[model samples]
Target chain A: MSRFTKIALIGLILFPFAFLLMLSLGKQWPYPAIFPEQWSLSNWQLVLGGSEGLGNSVLVSVLLSLSVATLSTSLSFWVSRHIAYHPKREAWLSLAYFPYVFAPVILAACLQFFFIVAGLYGTFGGVLVAQLFITFPYGVIFFSSFWNERLRSMEELVKTLGGSTAQAYAKVLVPVAKGALMTCFFQLFLISWFEYGLTNLIGVGKVPTLTLRVFQYVSEANIFLAALASCLLILPPVALLWLNRAVVFREG
Target chain B: MLTIKNINKQYKGEAVLQGLSFTLRAHEMLSILGRSGSGKTTLLKVLAGLETADSGQLLLDGQDLSPVPANQRGVVYLYQEALLFPHLNVFENIAFGLRLRRRPETEIKEKVNGLLQRLELPGQARKMPEQLSGGQRQRVAFGRALIIEPRVLLLDEPFGALDAETRRSMQQLLKRVAKDFGLTAIFVTHDLKEAMLMGDRLGMMQNGQLKIYGNRAEFIADESTGALDEARFWTDLQGLKLTK
Candidate 1:
C-alpha cells in the first residue's frame, strides 16, 4: 500500500487502545507524557461496571435501535418501490424530503406534540412514533436508488417471468437489496441509539436512552466516568461495524 | 394472430401515429424498423398493451386486446437489457412464469432443465445473472420469454447488447424458435442489417407510422433511390412537415 494508507493503518490500530488505557487510569498520568502513571480497573468499574443497573439503559438503546431500523426500512422499501416508478419520481422524492430536510428536530417536536395531544404521551409507542420520522429519511435515501435502478429492473424481469409484483419483491428485490437493507438498518439504528436532543426533548423524561444517561453523568463533573459511558456508548456501533466488516470494506 | 388498425399516439401534443395499421399472422416474425425516436418501440408498447393509444383498436385472435393487461395479454416484452433478476439463479429466472402459476415441482424442474440444455447453459442453473456474460444472460432471457409460451412476443432492441456474431446467432435462434413455437413476434430494431435479417416482413417507421413496408426486395428497391428519396421516405413515414 501507499505511505498514507500505511500510516492510516497504523493509526487505526494504536488509537483505540491508547485512549481506553488513559481513561481507565483516571488522573494517574506519567511525568511529562500522555501515558498514565498508574493503571487500574477502578474507573472502568466506576463507569462501566457500575452497580447502577445500567441494564435498563442498555436494553432501551438496543430495543429502540432495532425497532426504529426495522420500522423505517420496512416503510421505505414499499414506498420507494412504488414511488420509484412515478413519472415525476425525482420531483416527488424531493417533496418527501422536504419534511425531513427542513428542521427535522422541529418536525420531530411537532410530531411529539401531536402524539401527546392524541394521548400517546409518555408511552413506548409514542417514543417509537417520534423516532419513525427521525429514522425514516435515511432508509428512504438508502433504498430509493436500489429500488429505482437496480431492484426495479430485477422486479420487472421477474414479473415478465410470471412472478406477481409482490412475489418479485419478496423473492428477488429483497435478496439483491440485502446489502442496502443492512446498511439502512445499521445507520437508522445508530441514529436512534445516539440521539440525545430529540429523545430527551420528546420523551419528556418519561423514557431513558443511553444518551440521556451519558449527559446525566457528564454534567456532574465525572469526566472520566462520562468518557467511559461514551466509550460504552461507542461499543455497540463499533462491534456492529466489526461484525459486518464486509460492508465497511466496501464503503471504505 | 394480432391486428392493429388506425393506431394513433402522441407525446406532449406531438402526434406519433396517424392511422397506422398492421396485421401479424401466427408464427410470423415481423420486424419494426425505424431511426431513433420514430415511435417504433412506442408502437410495440401499444401492441403489448404496455401503452394506451389515443385512438385506434387492437385485436388479438379477433378479440380486442386493448383492455387486456400486459401480463394477461400473453404479450411478453424483452428489453434491450436482458433484465435478468440478479437475486435469482439461472433456473429460477427461466422458471419464473411457471413458478407464478404454481406449476408442479417435477414439471418446473423438467422444463427448466430443457431450457438450460436448449440455451447451452446446462451447468449454470445455480448461477446468478451477474455471473453470466452478456450473451449468456440474453440467451437465458430468450429462454424465459419462450418458456412462457406467450401468444405475442415484443422485443425492444433485444440484440442491441450483443456483439455482431452473437447477434447473428441470436437472430437465427429467434427465427427458428418463432417458427417452431408458432410465436407471432413483433421485433424492433433501428439497424438496417438487423431488421432485414430478423424479420420475414419488415415495416419502416418514421414519425408515428409505418411508411415503407414490404418484403426484402421492396425495401431494397426503395433504398436504391437517392439519399434525398430515402430522406423523403423517412419524412413521409413520420408525417413530418419540411422547410421546403
Candidate 2:
C-alpha cells in the first residue's frame, strides 16, 4: 500500500520475468535492458530430466506439508480450546508456545539430535516431525482466536441442545470454524513445504524437498531448472494465499 | 427442569456469583435482565454447564447435574451472532446433529425438510450462512439448535446484534419456537425492555448476584426503585441546566 511496499511488490513480480529473460538470453554479465530478446523451451527440458528428483521433490513437499498441517492443527485445537474454555486456561497460556517462541534453527537442531537418538534421522518421518515444530506455531496462532471468539462462548448453547463436546465440535464448532480450520491446515502446509532450516538439517542430505532440490540445482549452477522448480514450488502458496489470508494467525 | 443451589464463582480475584440459586421448570421461558458485568452471562454459562461454581449444587429433573459434561446435558445455547457453519449450507447445518447421531440419510432429509416447511423457510436448504441476510442467518442458527430437540434452550442475547425492527421480529419468532418445542428457555440480556417482552418471568442481576426476580409485571415495579433514583438524577440535571 505504501510507496516502498508498492515498489517492492513490483520488484518481486518482475524478478521471475527477469530470471526467465536471463535463462533464455544471458550470454554475459549484466545485460542492461527492460526485456530480453531471446526465448527458448530447451531450458525447460534440460532441468526437467524426466523430472526424476523434481517429481520426488514435489511429492515429498506435499507429504511434508500435509502431515505437518494435520498434526499441528490437531494439537492446536486441544491447546486452544482448553485455554479458552477451561477454568484455569490462563495459567497454561504463559507456556503455550515455548517451541514457537524459540528460534527455528535452534529448535531444528534439538529436534535433529532427538531424531538421531530415536532412529528417525534421514527419513521422511523425521523431517515431518521437525516440520511440525516449524509450523505448529502458525496453526496454534490461527486456531486460538477462532476457538475463543466463536466456539468458546457457543459451547454452552450447543451442549444444552443434546450435543456432546465431540458432537458440538463435529456439528457446530467445526462447521462455524471451517474456514479457520482450512486456513490453518493450508498455512501449516505452506510453512512446512517451504521450511528449509529443519528439512536441510535433519534430512541428513538424502531427503529432497523441492526447496532442497532447488538449492541443489542452484548450487550446481543449473539455474534454468531451478527456476522451473521454483515456479512449481511457488504455485501452491500463490493459489492458496488469497483463499486462506483471512484466517487469523500469528500473522495477525 | 434445571435447578441451581447456592452456586458461587470468582473471576480474576473478584467474586462474580455469590451463593446464586434458582430453578428452570419445563416449558417455561425465563429472561434474565442485568446491567453490564452483572453476571447474567455467567449465570447462563453455569446453568448450561459451560462454567463451574466454586460451591453449589445443580440438578435437572431431581437428578444432580454436576457429573454431566456440557455436550451430553441436552442443553442448546444460541449466541447473539448467527454462528452458523461457513462450510455448510443451511440444510447441512440443520441436519448436523442428526448426522452426528448417525441417523440414516433419508430420515435426516425428511426431518430437515419437514422443519424447513414448518419454519416457512422453504427452499433455503442449500444456501450458505453468508449468503443469507441477518434475519435469515439467525433463523438458520435457530434451526440448527432446534433440530437437536434438546430439553433446555439457552439464548445469550441471541438477537442483540440485530437492528431494532429485526430484533423485535426475532423475539416474536423465538417465542413461537419455544412454545412449539416445549422448551425450558433461559434468555439472557441487559436490555430490560427486551427481557420484559420475551420472558414469562424476569430475574435482575447486579454485581454478580441475582438481586431481584419475579414475573414480568413484578420485575418492572422492583426495578422502578432503581429507575426512580435515575429519574431523580435526570430531574436534578434539568434543574442545573435551567439555572445555568
Candidate 3:
C-alpha cells in the first residue's frame, strides 16, 4: 500500500474513537449543526469526580473483567489439559460448546432462579458468575488445541527426568504457553468487559458495570454521558491489544 | 540390572505386550528391533513408568518399580523428536534436571558444561532448540537426559528423524557416550542395521512377543529375525554389480 493509502486507512480506523471523544466533551448539538453549541471538560469532570457513579462503574467493570479473565484463563488452561487427554475428550469438549448454544440473556434467565435461591441474585457475585458461564467455556475451547502429543511427550519426558508434575508445568509447559495464556486472558477480558445481556439480567440494575452504564446513558438519550461511557469501555481492550501486539512481535 | 517379568498389556482386549519378559544387565544397551505397533514403545514406556503394564514386575537393581511414580523411577525416555523444551537454551535444557533437584548453581554449571563438551555441543550451549540442526537438538536432548544420571535411558528411535549421515553420526555419539558413562538403556528402532550396530545384545519383537538372541551370530542365523533376508538382498545387489 502507498503511504497516502496507509494514512487514510489509519485515519478511517481511528475516526470513530476521535468522534466519540469529541461527542463526550461536547453538549447541546441540535439538528443541522456539524458541531455542538458548547464544549467543555465538565462531563469528564463529573464522571471522574464520582458524582454520576460512572467512576464506580468503571472500577467495577475493571475488577469484574480482570477477575473473570484471570480465573477463567487459569482454570480452563488446567482443566483443558485433563479434558484433552481424557478418554471422553470429545464429549467434554462438546459440552464446552453448550453455553454458546444459548444466548447470554436466555442463559442468565435460566440461572436466575438458582442465583436467587443462593441469595446471589442482583449482586456483583451474581454478575461475575453469570459472565463465567460464557468466558470459562470460551477459554477451555481456546486452549484445547494447545495440548497435543508433542506437549504430552514433553511433560512425560520431564517426569522421567525426575521432575514432578508441578515442575513440568512451571519449568516447561507454562513458559511455552505464555503467549497462549496471555491471548486467552485478553479475549476473556474482552468478553466480560463488553458483556451486557447477562449482567443486566443477573445484576437486576444493582451491579452497575461500565457496559451497563453505557446502555443506561444511551437509552436515557444522554448522548454525551453515553459517549463518555463508550470511551471508558474501549480503553482497556485497546490497551490490552497494544500490549498483546508487543508480545506477539517480540515472540515473532 | 533391570528385569521385566511376565509383562502383559492389552488395548481394547487385544494384546499389545503378551507375557513379554526380558533382563538387561547393568551398563548394557539392549536394542530391540520391531515395526510400528510391534510393542517396542509400550515396553519402554512401562519401564519408564510412563505407562503401567497390565500385569508384570519391573525390577531395577532388584527393587520393584511399579509403585514408583515416573519422576522417582530414574528412567528417561527419549522420543523420535528431540522434544526439547522450546523456551530454554541448550545450557538451561541440560541443567533442567539439576535445577529440579535444586542442585548448587556451580554444580549445575559444571555438569551441564561437561556434558555439552562430551556431546560435541560445546560453544552451542546458549542456542535455543530451534536454532540447532536436527542432530544437534538430539545431542542436547541426550545431554539433558544424561545430566540427570538416569538409571535407564529408554530411547524410542531418537535418531529416526535425521538424515542418513546425521543418523550414523548420532549412533556413534550415543555408543561412545553410553560406554563412557556406563549407561544402561533400551534403544528401540525399526531399522535392521541400526538394531545390529547399537545393541550390546539384540532382541526382535513379533506380535508383542520379544525374542532375545544369545549373540550377534545367533541373531543373524535366525531367518525369522529377517537378518538373513537383509544379507541376501545386499549380496544379490553386489553380485548384480559385478555382472554388470
Q: Name the best candidate (by TM-score).
A: 3
Which rank order by TM-score, best down to worst?
3, 1, 2
- lDDT tens digits by residue: candidate 3, A1-252: 999999999999999999999999997899999999999999999987899999899899999999999999999999999999999999999999999899999999999999999998999988999899999999999999999999999999999999889999999999999999999999999999999999999999999999999999999999999999999999989999999889965896
Clashing pairs in 2: A157-B76, A157-B77, A160-B74, A160-B75, A160-B76, A161-B75, A161-B76, A163-B71, A164-B71, A175-B85
In order of lDDT, best first, we have 3, 1, 2
Error of 3 at A24 (Å): 1.2
Clashing pairs in 1: A161-B97, B16-B208, B206-B238, B207-B238
Interface RMSD for candidates 1 onward, in order: 2.2, 2.7, 0.5
In the range A1-252, model 2's lDDT, one tens digit per residue, is 899999999999888766754654332233575443555666555446654467677777877777788899888866677776667755665555777767777888777778999988898988887777657655655665665655555655556655667776776676566666777777777778788877888887678888888788789986656667787787777667765765544333
Q: Count residue pairs with overlapping backbones in model 3.
A: 0
- Position B181, candidate 3: lDDT: 99
Q: What is the TM-score of chain A alone in each candidate?
A: 0.81, 0.79, 0.98
Residue B82, candidate 3: alpha-carbon lDDT: 95
Tens digits of per-residue lDDT for model 1, B1-244 = 7888899998889997778888988888887778878898778777766678999999999999878766677788788999887667899888888888889999999988987887778799999888988888998998889888888888999999899988888888777777777778888898777887788887878778685465666776665323347657888977755543
State the weakest 10-residue window (summed lDDT) of model 1 chain B: B222-231
- Candidate 3: tens digits of C-alpha lDDT, residues B97-214: 9999999999998999899889998799899989999999999999999998999999999989999999999999999999999999999999999999999999999899999999
Across A1-252, the per-residue lDDT of candidate 1 in tens digits comes to 999999999999978755854674675654587665666777666546547545567777788888888899889877877777888888867766766664656876767668878887776677777788767766676766775554555555565455666777677777767777777778888888888766776777667777777788788866565666667688798888775567745644
Could you tell me the TM-score of candidate 2?
Answer: 0.74
* Weakest lDDT window of 10 consecutive positions for candidate 3 chain B: B43-52
Task: Give DockQ for candidates 1 onward, in order.
Answer: 0.38, 0.48, 0.93
